[model samples]
Target: MKNRMTLTFDSRSENESLARVTVSGFMAPLDPTMEEMMDVKTVVSEAVTNAIIHGYDSEDGKDIELHCAYENDELVIVISDNGSGIEDVEMAKEPLYTSKPELERSGMGFTIMENFMDHVLVTSSPGNGTRVELRKKMVAKDRVCH
Candidate 1:
């Protein structure tokens, strides 16, 4: 059996938690291991942060959309925003590379997403928008303590 869910939220750091909670709820029924939960949470955080910081430039009223599908023994998450897209995605992926150096960003958003998820794909264009998709294998819980 597989499950799917999608959520849209305003582009704000505060709303990142909502995204995590929604994903956590969807995965709860699957009884994911603790490490799986952490991976999901971290990836969601990085994606949401990118949407707010890079996409929207921390501007208020922008929107971010999150879509998740659990199927084929895997969990796939996609985060999208209709804000200023990256001009150079390849450069952004480099370690310690950041356009907003003044903000003290580590510029590791894409890198972290790649590391945390089994697979990550990014699509974007200047003035168009950005979408980050992450996929991870779902490991079913092995023990049930009641």
Candidate 2:
């Protein structure tokens, strides 16, 4: 089975959960394991939160895009924003390196995503935009026989 979805919404903190729920609901038919579901949700939350807070710098009226595709036991998720892009992608991915230390951000967004997902890719330029791609392979739960 193959399934895919794309969502676009205003870059707001409140809308972050919407992205997570949408992906979770989309993946329901696959009967993913509980751990897989939580991992997916966690990565979605991190990517969407980064798009709103870091990509757009909490500026209103900006748009964030989330795309999810499931095929052959693999799930691909892409989150993008057309806002101030990262100047240093490598540095940003380092643990505990937040751009907004004043906000008490731990700067672990990329790290968390990398740890949870099988593959992660980040692309950004200074003035263009930022895009985060996350991929995970779902292992089907073993059915118990009575």
Tens digit of lDDT per residue, candidate 1, span 2-102? Answer: 87878888887889899999889887766788988998998999899989999999996988999999875688899999999999889888978989999
Which tens-of-lDDT digit does each residue in 75-138 have in candidate 2? 9999999999999999999999999999889899999999999999999998899999999988
Regions of candidate 1 where Cα sits further than 4 Å from its true position: 140-146
How far out, in Å, is residue 53 in model 1? 0.7
lDDT of each: 0.87, 0.91
lDDT at position 113, candidate 1: 83
- Candidate 2 matches the true fold with a TM-score of 0.95
